[model samples]
Target: MVKEIKLLIKKRQSYIKEFWSYINWGIIVCSWAGVVIHIFRQTELKKLSNSLENVKGLKPISLTFFAYLDSLLTYLTELKKLSNSLENVKGLKPISLTFFAYLDSLLTYLLSFCCFFGTIKILRLLRINRRLSLLTLTLKKSAKQLLGFFLMFVVIFVAFNSLFYLLYHSYVRHYSSWLDTALTCFQMSSRHLSTIPDLKKIDTFIAAMSLFLFILLVVFMLTNMFVSIIVENFNIVRREPFNHENEVELIHFTIDKIRQWLSMSTRKRKIQTKTDPITEFPEKIDELMLAVDKLYGNTKR
Candidate 1:
């Protein structure tokens, strides 16, 4: 009975640790979500203000602390003229529906991606699961390659999307704007090509080429590389015990760097506090400083 109780207590502690890790990941994901929310809020604020006949009457909106106060002050100062300006306020640009949807869907996709990874992290709580351990270790080793591949894909996606947007926005009458071009490219890569309509022959050829590129790069090359990486690293993971001292060292190094950065200005400020610049230097520079100061003093005299 005592042995069973001890085992239960250990398992409970392990579960709590895993829960804490999952919560930490959730907090990190929430930070990213906050950024996305702020961006969308800015966009929506602009859309709202533009829709108003008198934007000067609208309240100030910003992500900064004193933004609302600044906007309020500006609006109050222009309150007398705000009524008069409403008569001729006809220059508001129509906001694109696709762009609005794109922003929202992008956020959803990102949140889902973070949650998927967080779920995987939580799954590591099963201490008896060797497969999970191996998978995690393999991913840890291949992290750099995955990041590099992601950056490469981003550059390619942006470049081709820009090319397609430029081509379609000019020649194809169906595409409403450049935003549609980006949305279409994203959709095509995901194998959801129903929304994009038919275009000019040249535009069609570019779209087809983009589809082929997505297949060749994202679907085949990167996927195959990742598979190979996992298989190669799995052997190493199986042979080596789970060692986290490197991660602890890395965390410590990161914290030290952050501390140094935060104190850098304070250190500089301290150096500046010296009335005589010569006093700020180490003893090694004292001789050079004395020679320069004496020469300058003599020259001035």
Candidate 2:
């Protein structure tokens, strides 16, 4: 039984090693391919823009592209309804879906370049630890990647805001008339908000609070999801014995082993005896000693 168990552990380890080996190669190839594709895409976009200039007022082409974009956007919005089901689709795990969703968000913002490079770095790091599970490593990598992205986001956000303010002061001041007209148009377009005398203050506060609450809710949901996955994986690792074959089998085997060891120890203790010879032979020894004394006294007499 011990030999069989050892064999199974060896087999499992071998499988894990092979799986990681394949994964490492796949990651390397995919990363290189992604870089090549990105470069090709940029070149293509440049060529496309040059081609667009030669075509006078490609309104039809622009309309078709916009039409497709609108359809795609509508489809994606509707797909939200199936988010729960899509998450558990056949061969697709929740973590995998979450990862793709993160990628999709990054791609939409043209920030996938950061993710691509981050993934390559993560893969290289992973190659150093073959014993680490892919899911565990991926979760860790995803967290670090997200942190990097958040930092980038902060830097970009601050830089853009600063640039915008600088441009606003330098350029917009020179177009004060245009700015005034634009502000007036915006105010006129949004006159309904100002015109509501009775509900104006109430609406303003409610609107502001509602927006704040919505933002908070979104942040809470995302945080919950991230924490939940980490906790779930941690729990799985905690409850599972590293060398256990199956969880159920491991539990039964552990119980049996404990029971057998207890029984053997109990039996061994029962067979062990410490006898007192004086208690069992007290008469024989006393008579022999009395006879010896009598013989000695008779000799003396």
Candidate 3:
């Protein structure tokens, strides 16, 4: 049954590979189309600007080859943002439209950045099946730990930033701007630890400490998950019976092979004898006894 399941998994994986090959080509074509559209739009804008009387002598600067690369990146980013916006529309059940819009904006920005790295990962997966397989297995084992760490890290970071903002608003009455207040608070926090102290500073310190602890906890949990997964898979792969009920079958096969080789060796030893067969039998018996003794010794050690 396990072997059948394994074969089924292999077949499914082959189907997935074929599906991804077509999907990857489609994405590549669409991405190129987006790039071409961007280039055409830019060209038309430049032409319009050049048609003006005051811009007759002002030639538009030619975009460097790298600019085309940048445009491709920008296109992918926009595609990811559009996908996230659609997700936001789907998630507008329990939340207000305004709140959903803000959530959508934040999620879209975060997902856009995530999509860039995801694109790179997908490319790698297409190029190397073994690495992708290993990564997939690792992700499956650590998914819960990874999600826990991500949520904890985000919560701690946001809480610290929010507390800092609140403290700035409460203490400082007149500042040039929010940025100035932020900079001033950061400078003050760095300058005096013992000279000037207050509850707000203590609150900020506690928040920072909580953030540090959360980060440490995340690291420890992830490391534990990674190590446990590797060890478990290694044991599963290297086990003698391959975690099946055919252990005695394998042992019997191995013993038969060993007996055949020993029989052939004994025949050769008999044919090449310079001494009495009776004497040689005792020596061979002694050798066998010594080998068994050594095996036992090693096992004990």
Predicted model with the maximum TM-score: 1
CA shift at 281, candidate 1, in angstroms? 68
Q: On residues 56-118, what C-alpha lDDT tens digit does candidate 3 reach at each position? A: 333333323212323446645654553444353332233222332333344344445545544
- The reply for model 3, stretches above 4 Å from the true place, is 1-33, 36-40, 52-132, 168-301
Rank order (by TM-score, best first): 1, 3, 2
Say which prediction, candidate 1 or candidate 3, comes out ahead on lDDT.
Answer: 1
Worst 10-residue lDDT window, candidate 3: 264-273
The most accurate candidate by lDDT is 1
TM-score of each: 0.38, 0.23, 0.33
Q: How well does candidate 1 score on lDDT at residue 71?
A: 44
lDDT of 1 by residue, 1-301 (tens): 3543465477876755443444555646665785776588567646645566355544443323321223445534444343444445455454333454445445655666667666765645543345655666677677777778778877877776776667667666534576777777667666675644565355567667766776687667766776776787777778887544223233445566787988742221222222565765677588898999999999999
Every candidate's lDDT: 0.59, 0.46, 0.48
lDDT of 2 by residue, 1-301 (tens): 3443465477876745443444444545555665565465455445444544554423323312321232456646544643543443454333222333333343333434445545655554443333444455446535655575557545543443343234333333321354543443234233323422332333567435533443343334434555666676556555554542222343444576787878743222233345687776987788999999999999999
How much is the lDDT of residue 120 in candidate 1? 62
Error of 2 at 100 (Å): 32
Q: Which one wins by TM-score: 1 or 2?
A: 1
